[model samples]
Target: MEFVITGDGSNTLYHPEIGEHYHSKHGALQESRHVFLDMGLHHFLAKEETNEVSVLEVGFGTGLNFLLTADDATRRSLQLHYCGIEAYPLPTDVIFATGYHRFVQPATWAAFMQNYAQALTTEVDFAEHIRLKIAHEKLMDFQTDDQFDVLYFDAFAAIHQPEMWSDQSLAHICSYLKPGGIFVTYAITGNLKRSMKALGFTVEKAPGAPGKREMLRATKVG
Candidate 1:
């Protein structure tokens, strides 16, 4: 395996030897789909307008979230304006090595992967209503003039990527949110919650997926 995967191989989807990170024994994809996509994304879309939803995702990771979101948007026939940031990008070979195809169909997965791949080298429109712009830079240096209705803070776990979870960085992200905008993440640390509250977010602890205690979903209230 190109990357090392941790936790039990059965529970974890990616090859432990090939994956660079792990959220639970169930694997990173399981964690992301369950926590962020199913719980967070589904929740956000339920109460908001999807004709055009602006999204900001930190730690783009393997772009699984983006792909899922894109597919959802296409399925829903909604417009999507996605902006994501990442410091270190994994190679396409590495990403494919994770066996994403096993979940997504071959044809559909190929189209999805192509869009994701094209996103890296260009900021272009995938479809009439779908546009993707990625910043191949560290989150700290990323500054956007646009406001987002939803933010997916998918940085590494606090223990591994402490800098990405700092109050200052979160505050910076909050500056670009529309009033009542929502921010979701798998982290629910005490300090992180306090920091979010300090930044003017009304925080709520939601039911976390298996193997996790709680996840955070906060909204920026005017």
Candidate 2:
């Protein structure tokens, strides 16, 4: 795994074996804030009546998404139960090398790193509003009866990890969402949109984060 700086000055890991970056080369922070934070979490919070929100993230590569969501949840005063599934967790060295902590307030970063140290071992309460549970397991093998109000599908591109973007896999993941739950991702492929539709999601093509044309947001319509 190589740490490479993205266009937005944020770092992302490049897996040479898979030939995929953990985030958009355009901007890791930009992509996460746009697709996951803005489109997924905020969108869910806006429409949902509950003070607490449940979120499941497909790829927890560098914990960027979780950290960003935790920050937002704290600021919004919304309780967030965040579950992140990652088959291969990055080493602490790689995570530190990314310099993600430099981007946030010192207090927030400190809390994030403290929880991150025990991320794979147990659920960590980064803040009163943010409780994170990291599962070191493949998404396909993950089992949970808890349903989510938001799903951040930040997996590698369908081309690199086709199984992750397959109709069967998407359908399976969608089963974990509550009705009217929001789903967001950086991938905006035609086949993916169709697959979401076939699975009963009302899909929308949202403006991409950067260095891309568009992204996708879908809602489970029941």
Candidate-wise lDDT, in order: 0.74, 0.87
Give the Å shift of residue 36 in candidate 1: 1.7
Candidate 1 residue-wise lDDT, 92-196, digit = tens = 766666655666545546765667667776676866778887777887788777998888888767766678788878888778888888888887989988999
lDDT of 2 by residue, 46-151 (tens): 7877789999999898989988887777777888899998998888777767888866767778887677769787888778778888889888898888999999
Candidate 2 ranges with C-alpha deviation above 4 Å: none
Best by TM-score: 2
Error in Å for residue 206 of model 1: 0.6
| Per-prediction TM-score to the true structure, in the order listed | 0.85, 0.95
TM-score of 1: 0.85
In model 2, state the lDDT of residue 107: 76
